[model samples]
Target: MVDPLLLQLAAAGAAIVGFGWLALAMDVHWEQAQGQRPQPAPVVRLLRVLGSLALAASLGLCLTADHASMAVLVWFMLLAAAVLTVAMTLSWRPQWLRCLWP
Candidate 1:
């Protein structure tokens, strides 16, 4: 079995990446990002695909990391971390998000 901590970190990474995909899918967010304009349709589509994949991977990480109950806790905790990271990044350094999307 995988280390729970490692799985937690992976989950966090996935959430962040998923957030990037979410950001890429939005026009308004792009407009506000540092030097980033709206992406083309193909790019948006790609982002959607990647975002979904990342989120799914996060779930997989959690489930495989531990038993069901522990996995649920770790997964949700990592998700919260990911959300906080995204929110903080968007608030303080949206340019960073543009870097990911662009």
Candidate 2:
């Protein structure tokens, strides 16, 4: 039988990686639209890289979590991450996000 917890962790990991790519793409598009001279902002780039690393670590931790309940919580967090991605894609309207997130 397939382990449900493993499946949940795999889904969470995929979601995190997917969002990381999406964020990178959005950053590129935003920069291109600005039409400013492309200058690498060290601090901002460092933060984004660190954030991606953190998400990868979270994925690892989620996969190793032993408790089924913890897996469920991780799944919920993954869902929240997906929702946040959608909200960001939709221009980050406060009211719509507040209804679901707050």
Candidate 3:
């Protein structure tokens, strides 16, 4: 049987991470439009990292507490991580991206 609590937690985590990404994107764009460098603030960076970790933990929780399959968990985690990566890429310059990515 599906554990309702696990499902609720997973959904909440996903929503939080998704909204975080959207906010990051909007902030970056707003800064760029105002003729400012679109660098991520320290708090934003911390939040991104924390959000990624939380999403990963949420996936693990779902896997353990519910009947979710391994494949589903893996894909969901990967997708969440990928969104963070893409946001980082778009919000920073090439040198910053290289330093972070490489």
Looking at candidate 2, the ten consecutive residues that score lowest on lDDT are: 93-102
Instruction: Give all candidates' CA lDDT scores.
Output: 0.78, 0.52, 0.52
The TM-score obtained by model 1 is 0.84
TM-score of 3: 0.40
The residue-by-residue lDDT of candidate 2 on 24-54, one tens digit each, is 3344533433334353566346546654664
Error of 1 at 35 (Å): 2.8
The candidate with the higher TM-score, 1 or 3, is 1
lDDT of 2 at 83: 46
Given candidate 2, what's the lDDT at residue 98? Answer: 22
Model 1 lDDT tens row, 30-61: 66674545468988788889988898899888
Q: How do these models rank on TM-score, best leading?
A: 1, 3, 2
Tell me model 2's lDDT, rounded to 2 decimals: 0.52
Candidate 3 clash figure, as a count: 0
Tens digits of per-residue lDDT, candidate 3, 1-102, equal 667565656655564454344444355433543345554567456656655665666566556564667636654765666566556655664233322211
Error of 3 at 53 (Å): 1.2
Residue pairs in candidate 3 whose N, alpha carbon or C atoms collide under 3 angstroms: none
Each model's TM-score, in the order given? 0.84, 0.35, 0.40
